[model samples]
Target chain A: MNFWFAVFRQAGRNLRQTWTSQLMTFLTVSLSVLIFAFFYLIYTNMIGAGDRLSDDLRLIVYLEDDPGPEMQEQLRRKINNFDKTESIQFISKFKAYERFAEQLGEDSDVLTDMPKDFLPASIEVVPLKSLRGYNQIKLFSEYLATLPGSEKVQYGQEWVERFYYFTRLITIVVLLSGALLILTATFMVAYTIRLTIMGRHEELELLKLVGATNNYIRTPFLLEGIIQGFMGSILGLSALYVLFQWISLHFAGPGLLNLFNFTFFPPMVIVSILLGSIGLCTIGSFTSIQKFLKI
Target chain B: MPKLVHNQDPIEPKDIPGNTMIEMIKVSRTYAPDIKALSDISFTVDTGELFFLIGRSGAGKTTLLKLICNMDTPSNGLIEVAGYNIHNLKGKKLAHLRQKIGVAYQDFKLLSDRTVAENIAISMEVSYKKPRAIKQRVRDLLEQLQLTDKHDALTGDLSRGEQQRITLARSVANSPRLILVDEPTGNLDAATTERVMDLLTRCNKAGATIVIATHDSSIYKDGNHRVMELRSGKIHSLSRNNR
Candidate 1:
């Protein structure tokens, strides 16, 4: 038989003989990976929400009362020339009054009582996508405040920036915790494998004595680790997907899905899962074999 | 009339003809700073020779065997097996060297999870033998050892003697040039010991050098084979029969 085929067959036999131990390993791997996936999902959703909030924000530069047409055109030109400005829309006083009237349909008298002089014309500046972040929008708005005949600059960027900062902090914390958890899980799994190998040290020694090379002796254990890691990742990912779908279906509130309309995992998640499983198994195998298969 | 021979404890050294297959020159094995297991010992095993190393416990017989297999290194000496200096071999070449040598442990190092066939197949598998060839070889070994009926039995489920035989079968399955047996008869009954020794004799006749380390000398009468008696970390004498 091929060398690897023998390794695999031996690994299969080992797994069959120690099904309980293998099952325990599988559960440990699956739970750890599942926790990681859940945390990653949360982190991804928070980032997506922050991005959407920034995208929808616009900078409003309120106009001075009775500004002349030349000044208006000058301001419009100035707004257009700004590097951060993507598009500018001029809201005339009449259109503002009409919008007010529309909003107060049942209370039209309140809109009629407000004098025409009380309304202020404004220019809405939509910034480029790169300038849509909290700090970037704040800097842009502060610069716009110094413009001539500008009554005030109003944008929800400050609150959004605060939310972004808080959520970004949360994402960092969650990501760090996830990383630590993954390391812990890997170490634990490796130790378990090592102990299991120790229990069968005589068998391993026999194999070495019978002319089994390091690779041939280690292949089965490595495959076992990989199988456990794969099973864990799949279980974790399936659980996360189910949880995400269930939350999306039942809990339509201001949490992750509703606030961000968070996108589901693309093909990349599957690739990541494969890579993660293989990487963990490789590390576990390398470590276990380093000590067990020596001489 | 039947021949009458003296039952000496160890035969005289002049009777042994040297055709060395394994040689160790001034070998000293010291673990850590002060633990000296074997010190300045030299010996040789001839081709197709059946030799016994007799000593009490902690006499370094196991360590000697391990050194021959290159599993452990000696503190100082030149150790050669099958005409290669063992310390220089590494990686696949070391594996190749090990393939030429077979070792049996007193613990009966059979893979408990595997069947008798699989346990025996490991030897051929490492040598990269073809599947059909491995199957045929395993079948032939099973028949030779009278273990054909237990081919599918788990190694752990077999009796002590059967397990030891399986270990022996695995050791000789690759038809190694040299076999290092550590306490081969330590755990076997009298009948089983005789049977195992008979098998070893057969293997020696087939041209494989056999070196057995044990404390049991009741069954091994003097003048039957060469005997090396070790005492206090040194070879007290090396003798053989004048057959």
Candidate 2:
């Protein structure tokens, strides 16, 4: 028989012999990968959502007093000089009041008795795509607040900071779970390989006695570990893809998640994860086989 | 101290007549501190000699055989087999040495679940023999021992004599440079024993060095070969067959 063929055949036999436990080991690794990928997907989309929100970032410069025509032109030029603008609009005090009443709807009566000049006029600035990042917006807001007739500049600073930190936390979780997946995959592979060695103790000894090389004897077991890692990663990624598709389809319309625009891992990333997991399993298998077959 | 026939001029395996296939100098094996199995005994076998180790139950026959194959380490001494010093052998070197040596166990150490053909083919498979060649060799070995009908039978399902023949067949399947047999006829009938001996004799004549460790005198009684009789973990006498 071809040496490789026999080695794989032996591996198949071992897997079959301990199939119940082997299946459990496989599932364990898959679920670990699933958990890791779940967190990773969420982390990626959160960051994507954060970036998307930044793309639509608008900073409003509220004024203490309305500027004169010449002063308004001067303020516009100052804003332009600060950074490029997609569109700069001057919302007058009346326009601001109208918008507030429209937003309140039935609650408009609560603001009906308020003075017409109650709301302050503001200059709404929507920065260019490249200048919409948090730090850029923060710096631009600080600069805008100092503008001639500007009272304060705001882009819901508190909310953006909170969301940024939230994504940072998810990044941490993703990294932690990634390390966890590595440990789980390698440990499960090692445990399974060790069990197979124990079960075939007598058979292995006979093979050794019959002049089988350590390489020959352990090739099948190592192949078993590698196959387990490969299958587990594939299963986990497929499940994650299914989840991504279901979420994408069910929440297709505009919603909070729609802002996320979920994207599954690229093919390259998937291949890397698969190869990485296989590498971990190979280490596990090699170490366990070495420990058992010291001769 | 048992008589030792050490190599005066050790030579390469390719060299002629006086080339010692096995050279042991004051070999001793002890278990757990002081339980001597084979003590201060030594001997040498020529390139193609069929040698016998005769001893009673505790006579250290099996221990001596184990030491020769590097299965058990001697508490002290050097064992050189086919030119490799087995005492310190390891890794690929040890594997290479074992690949050239075939051993039959007293317990008929066959994979009970594997078929007779597979059991014999293992020796060849470990050496990377082609499938067709392995199949043909298995068939030939089984046929030689009158076990052609039992080719597909699991070793566990075979009779004692059949298992014995299968073990012997497996040991010589690779055409090893050395063959070590322990209790070759322990489970064999008279006729089966005769057939097993014939096959071994044929292998010996074909130039593989042979070592048989047994307590059964009937197997080596009238054979023209060297015999080392052991008593209580040491050699009692080393003599050539008189008949």
Candidate 3:
């Protein structure tokens, strides 16, 4: 415990002694962490939005003309019995025709000229929440088409599938990029700390001479690196929070916020980022001090 | 005391008697292919004995001190200090060995950024001495070394002689079993040299093994302690005073 206390005290001293170098290192690490957090927020938000979109998806199944009411009831029962179907409701031919007429405009004669049963009655099918993909929807629709009364099965909004795939791709890219950024930051922190240790080479030699262990000497440097990383993390998190607030205040209107909603990282994510930066700095200092301690 | 052998074989620390504090057998240190710093060196220093290694510059005096402290390893042969073989020592064991030892370099390697008191306290701090005890010990050492008034002075701002005293104070702060001094009085005046030697003699009387490496004839002329003169890395002669 005493050794650790001494190490911490030494680290504080180091910061005071070489503020300029320490500041530069802190800023570099903060910038790296900031970039990582930005992408991470985007990836998380995208996944969240995708989940909501998936739950609201609906599949439309148009029936052959004038299937008896009893057949429609059987089809509904069959859809409900299928594990993938969450809910199913029938839309009569008249209602479907009226809805299309409204879409075509009130003055349009297209719907008025058609026969009473011209538009096919349809079943609006909501699949299970878990089945939310282009392939899943296509497979479910094909199953519907093979049924007794379904003339055509159409799941609207092809764009949602494309968006899901795009988000998945972004997730993969963000993960790789975040890993690369952290590794690079670790090496940079290590190099900067190596320079700090070099500046105190004489003191280290003296410490060794005075029966101080390699652990004792290295602990201070390790602690120094960790502190630098922690400070950088705090600075980065604050900057990110401020930027989020600025965007939320200025560009928070309907269309803009919908595209990329800006929000502060949740409590858990913030804690992890803080701890991760500290851990990274520790690794960096540990590696850099090896060569010097070997001497 | 264990017998010193000239054979180039690793000596087990257990083979050495408990009373033998430092034992080196056929120790050879070579920097490179052609630079043979110390070759075929063999010696032993008993517990609580004051030994002096007399040699000119580059005579491997510093190298020998480093080897004893496990700061450097021998190219061949064995070095046993405080019941641990130096060649095989590493990590915690090596550090433990050094904790019982102290070395005052020829050049005073004091922390310039720290005050004289901090420099002295470091010696005890490495040993994990309590803060209160460390403070008292530093106070006692500073008073003994006549550096009491310079406790708050920066080491870098002090004169060479004062810096040398601070180095000595730091070495003995933990009351180590073996104290190694290299030309400690090199920058001191006659009065200061006497005072410094007196402090070392007092430490010796307290049962600490003392090894003083110096080229000064005044230290060995009296033959107060066992003296070994190194002529180009090999021990030329060994003698002791008729106490």
Per-residue CA lDDT of model 3 for A1-295, tens digit only, reads: 2776677777887888888878888998898788888778778878777676677788888877655779878887777666457788888888887888888895758656678677889888998887776777777777888888678887665676678678878888788867865886688779877888888888787777776777788888888878878888898888888887887888877874665554567899999999999899889988989989876
DockQ each candidate and list the results: 0.32, 0.35, 0.34
Residue-level lDDT of model 2, residues A47-125, one tens digit each, is 7788878876799999988777888889889989989989888888988999999999998999968987789999999
Best by lDDT: 2
List where candidate 3 sits over 4 angstroms from the true fold.
Answer: A68-83, A98-118, A138-153, A251-264, B1-16
Chain A TM-score of model 2 comes to 0.78
Model 3 chain A weakest lDDT span, ten residues long: A255-264
Output the lDDT of residue A77, model 3.
74
Please give the lDDT score at residue B65 for candidate 1.
85
Q: Which stretches of candidate 2 lie over 4 Å from their true place?
A: A66-150, B1-12, B15-18
lDDT by residue (A175-280, candidate 1, tens digit) is 7756755675577568767876877787777667665667777778777777777777787778878888887888777865677786567779767865786578
- Tell me model 3's lDDT, rounded to 2 decimals: 0.81
Clashes of 2: 0
The DockQ of predicted model 1 stands at: 0.32
Which sequence of candidate numbers ranks them by DockQ, best first? 2, 3, 1
